[model samples]
Target: MNLLRTLAAISSMTMVSRITGLLRDTLFARAFGASPYTDAFYIAFRLPNLLRRLFGEGAFSQAFVPILAEYKNQKGEEATRSLVDHVATTLVWATVVVSVLGIVAAPLILMGIASGLDGDGFDKGVVMTRLMFPYIACMSFVVLAGAVLNTWREFKIPAFTPVLWNLSSIFFSLFLVQYFEVPIYSMAVAVMVGGVAQVAIQIPALKRIGMLPRLSFNPLSGLKDPGVRRILKKMGPAVFAVSAAQISLLINTNYASNMGGGAVSVLQYADRLMEFPTGILGVALGTILLPSLSKANADGDIGEYSALLDWGLRLTFLLALPAAVGLAALSTPLIAALFNYGEFNAANVAAATAPLMSYAAGLLGIILVKILAPAFYARQDIRTPVRIAIGVLIATQAMNLVFVQMLGMGVAGLALSIGLGACLNALFLYTGLRRRSIYTPHAGWLGFFLKVVVAVVLMGLAAWFSQAQLDWAGLRSHPVLRIVALLAIIALSAIVYFAVLFALGFRPRDFMRRAK
Candidate 1:
């Protein structure tokens, strides 16, 4: 496979997903703004989202995919299909139990995460949490199908299916708000609908691949499958790895909740902005690399395995650095143009900008984590990342103490802590890979770094100049002009970045590689 072309395909589909997600956030900000109610809803949404990451795409995918790949590569078609069916049955049963428990324990969970929430906010959070709890089940199934599809090298469907969820949320944010007694409940409704839509869209694709899982009616039916046992054993550490990261987020949300009414909402706004590049670049590369990496490992081809990691790292820096620079340099305009409307005003935009810049500061590190960690996961070495994650969790909380409590940087401190921790995590993962001699840097890295640095510096300057040309929040009455100006600034900055790279002897083909 041409990895560059495959990466582009997945990234393009992911870009569409991110674009719609931004639109959904934009609409949400306009309709709701930053409020206790919005905070309530965000807090409510975080649990199911945490589960989606933990059980769906995070731990489960890390553990399941490589094993599924092994089944396909070593055990042949019938065995691989059997593995899928058993895994599907096991995952469904597990998801159902977690969903029921989450629903029943909604209030306790809310209190555990956001103890500082007001009585009314707490009540609303509980209701929304209950409403969205089952979303985990839908998303679990979605991720299960997505993993199967990605392992089959059918990347388009998995990448495109997320757009369905974003559209569902956008629809609810647009048309359903007025019907709810508490308008934020509409978002909870959107989550469930979107989850189902995501799952529904992948069914035919799975069938076409002949990997459609025939789920057992009885939960115990798949418990004894050898492949399922292997997955479960791997998931033990994988769960801890994902859980450690979620615990840090839970701690941050708790801190944000106590900070004030709008704290969680603003951090969420900044996070949505950060997700744009991470999804397009980090997620796109990670999604494609894992299956390929696992294939190399399964074939016992050490050279191909190391080369794949090198390719992903080089591509990550090539793309992620400029994105980070653009975000930091144009934080105000980006936040203002996209979110400063109706309920979300100048102050909210300003509030969100600090965290966005902090997030941008570590954007490369954040994305690097995506690239480097998969080196271990593809080898089915989940323990290494889990240990690193646990240690990073501890270090992050320590930084939070100094940055948030001691320094009183508030939401920005929380974000900065996470960013720096990600850098620390990525650094450790890199050192581990080097120590194990799993990855060796290819020649021309020095030249590549220099070219990227010069190009990124130029792009950053362009972004700075563009942001200075607009009173982003002041032009709220001229929404069309504000949006057009933002788009032009982004376009011109991108042109300057890529143009500089081309002049510096960087070409698309220089970075392209074949997986086989």
Candidate 2:
């Protein structure tokens, strides 16, 4: 398989989903505004989403894929299919139990997670949480299905499946909100609808690939396989390791809940902006590289493993640097164009810009974790990453205490701490890889790093200069003008960024194919 081609396909589809997500956020900002209702909805949606990352995307897939790949490679089709059927059967039962319990425990969970919220915010969040809890069950099946397809190299449909989540949320936020007296309930229902839609869309893909598990009530079927035990063992540590980002989010949410009034929403908007490039670069690379790296590890080919990691790292650096720089520089305009309408005003945009820049400052670090953590995971070394995650979490809380509570930095403080922590997480992983000799540079990394830095510098200069050309008045005064200006700035920065890299002896073709 062409690794670059695979990355491109996944990233492109993910990009579409992220775009729709942005539109959904825009509508959310316009409809819900920065109120207790908005905060409640975010809190409601986030709890299940956190576990989604933990169980679905973060832990389950990481453990399942490496083992699944090993099974397919070492065993025959019968063995591989049997493992899938049993695991699928087991996961379905577990998901149902978790969803029912989560729904029943909604109010208690709300109090536990978002304790600062009180009265209406607290009550409303409990209602919304129950409405959205079943989504966890739906998406659990969705991601398990997705992991199966992804392991089989059926990347597109699974990657594009997230479009359902965004589309349903947007439809509800835009159209259905008006019908509901309390708009957030509609949004919660949309979450459930979208989850079902996402799972439904991917069902046929599994059949097409002949990998779909025939769901059965044989709860103990998975216990018959040693691979299931191996996956569960890995999952224990992998959950915390892969969920470092979401942990940071929960921490931030706890603090932001105390801050009162729109702080959470502002931070979220900034995160949404940061996620655009991340979806394209970090997510794209990480998802594609894991299976490849696992195969390489299974073959005991250290050279191929290192080479795949190297390729992913360089590509991440190439993309993440300019994105980080561009986002930090252009935060104001981007926020203004997409979100500075309806209830989102100048003050909201200004508030969001700080966190946006703060988050952008750590974009490379945040994305690097995505890039590097998989190397540990593919090799089934989950404990090292878990240790790193623990250290980073402590560092994050200390910084949060200083930045948010002591220094009074407010929402931006949470953003800054997250960025700094991400840097530490990536650094720890890099050093660990070196010490273990799990990954070594293929050659030309310093040159590649320097070249990307130079390009990003030029790009940043161009972005800074271009922003000077547009005042706050012209950028935000009219919707059409704001859209045009933001696009122009983005295009100009991208051109300069790529042009500089191209002129400095960097070729796009080189990145598309790994160094031989």
Clashing pairs in 2: none
TM-score of each: 0.99, 0.97
lDDT of 1 by residue, 1-516 (tens): 899999999999999999999999999999999999999999999988998898878889999989999999999999999989999999998989999999999989998999889789999999999999998899888899989999889999999998988899899888888898888888999988998888889889998999888999999989889889989988888876655646677789999999888899999999989989999999999999999999999999999999999899999998999999998998998899889998998899999999999999888888898888888989999889999998999999999999999998999999998888889989999999999999999898898899899999989998898789778889999989988988998899899999998887777888789988
Task: Give me the candidate number with maximum TM-score.
Answer: 1
lDDT (Cα atoms) of all candidates against the true structure: 0.90, 0.87
| lDDT tens readout by residue for model 2, 1-516 | 888888888998999999999999999888777777788888888889998889898999888988998998899788888888888887788878888999999999998888788899889999999898888888888888988888888889988999998999998887788898777899899988999999899889988988888777777778777878888899988888888878989979988888887777888889889989988888878888888888889999999899888888888888899999999989888888888778887888888999999999899998999889989989989899999998898899999999988999999999999999999999999999999999998888888898888889989999988886776534555789778878898999999988888888887678765422
